[model samples]
Target: MPRNDAPDDQAPVASSPPTRLALIVRGGWEGHHPVAATELFLPVLRESGFEIRIEESPDVYADAGVMRDVDLVVQCMTMSEISREAVFGLRDAVAAGTGLAGWHGGIADSYRGSSDYLQLVGGQFATHPSRAPEDRPGDERDNFLPYRVEISEAGREHPITAGVGDFELTTEQYWVLHDDLIDVLATTTHPVQPYHPWHRPIVSPAVWTRHWGEGRIFVATPGHTPEVLEQAPVRTIIERGLLWAARTPSE
Candidate 1:
């Protein structure tokens, strides 16, 4: 449920040009294609002038020195356990001004066991309706249905959502439990279906941003598969989100 409106203000302006450092820590469920998904954005980030580093282990989160100098963290882990030391290191880094950004379950559904990590992310995946009839007991067909993602009023005004508009996507529409503090940028409604619990349409945030201490957090939920991410608008949103989180100066 979305609880707040977009702030009535101009988008942030970076004070100066700086060589941003980004850490992409990826690994967990292969179903989400953690490696490929992360790689999809590598070129864009590189062309944007970011000094990129890739790591497969969550242990990187435990290193305070490494996290301290990083400007952005792109996480792709899903449903994995993180150590107390690592979790704290990540929390402290973000709180101290390092930005965090991710798509789908990479950031949202990760570490179901870590409440502190979820608190910083502002949301968690509840369920993604199954498309296979066998997976959906008593249902006749798959739940994968075409849906239109409507850009929120705030999204129209935000730099991260520049040139983005309502778009159609046929994929698993995620149901998420989210915090009220997040600024919703875009959303979609669940149509009444055989497997749905609600009789009426239910709205969910498709993209959002939130603040954690001195840091920023950005999330976009449509990238379940590479095809979805390949969509022009989706790619644009993610690129802009990464830049926004990193606080990079716009030319």
Candidate 2:
């Protein structure tokens, strides 16, 4: 007890342990695999050292304060309605330095009628539920197919893709409004399917990350099913994304 000394040669003090991450994983529409996909991601998030707070009930969105004090937010809610105040609350929190992230329709295709939400999120789901003319969905909603994704220019050096090489998977390739501002992490090209009445070939964005003030954001359009994430490329992207989104990008 008499020896009182601080070692100057020792390493600097480490920060506090990571706290609970408010994982707002709400569920809706089988078209998006809400429950199944959320379950698949929870374990991975925990392995990344997060204490998940799931919101299987839609009521979670009713509480505007749900975003408070959370280290990060991993939203898995799909096709659900939230009060305008709730969106603003979460948006403000993120802009004020809280982390926000999600995948696929849960974030992009979500809140189809809310333009305010779209502005805050950067992109929105323009269209989907399409088929390849001769390729009928066979009375099924989920359309799984093999696809190749090309990582974007800015995304190559990000930690999320550090060791994650370009890869392929069989799942719903999300078609969305292409944006130039986003640091796209990966992409999937959807040639005008025979069933799609539109005559434009679509190059859909599958994974992306962005900066929001002191916060970070990530979006992926691949988890159309619980199994969609098991694909190597998909899993690595999310694994690194959670870590990256929870912290600031190096300057």
Candidate 3:
């Protein structure tokens, strides 16, 4: 018969798992407001049990020891240069399973001079067409235009974008030049306006992902400012993207 009393020797209590490490490498063009933009997501990162390490330079990417244990990298540096050593170190870290994710020019338009870096990111920001002279407002509004981000069939099934319907934004719509290696999740089309030179509507990838070796990468062409990043749908997508891109136990 089973005894009512508990056994003298008890099973060991399972301890909570350790928190993952997330490295936030941000700095470069102040226009992107990297600090504010990245800070908006700190709570999301912390709530997910991430031990955050913030850095203002890409040089941190060159630190092999640090990169080795990093589970994720959130980069926001735009229009800056990264050294060869740093590029290789970053590349190696991701290829070895460290996730990398960023938005707008922070990832797509960064390091214009580093082909290796471009190859790793799989895209480059060509330009965001501004209003014609007659319509120019002589301010940030000059480049701000309303556009729709349409979700692809794959995005509807992907964890990062699932349930997030197509949204509209009155912001800079990046024209990214990318190759076939990327998995496009969303796209934006620039319509031919009477003031613009383009003859027809042009569609560009607005959000995408790439698989590099054992790692994963995510990019969203929105988030031009902190306010934009704060939008419900954009914030939701970004938060999910960050977690989805993190290094998994098996990876």
Highest TM-score, which number?
Answer: 3
- In model 3, what are the clashing residue pairs, if there are any? none
**Each prediction's whole-model lDDT (CA):** 0.85, 0.70, 0.92
**Model 3, span 1-251: residue lDDT tens:** 98776665775668876789999999999999999999998899999889999999999999999999999999999988999999999999999999999999888889999999999999889999887777778998799888899999999999989999999998998888999999999999988888777899988999899999999999999989998899988899889989999997555
Each candidate's TM vs. the true structure?
Answer: 0.86, 0.82, 0.95
Best by lDDT: 3
Off by over 4 Å in 1: 1-18, 131-143, 247-251
Q: How many steric clashes does model 2 contain? A: 2
Tell me the number of clashing residue pairs for each predicted model.
Answer: 0, 2, 0
Residue-by-residue lDDT tens digits, candidate 1, 172-198: 788788889999999888767676566
Which scores higher on lDDT, 2 or 3? 3
**lDDT tens digits, residues 43-149, model 2?**
76687667778766434544656665566777777777776776777677677676777888778776677676676677777655445546655755445566778
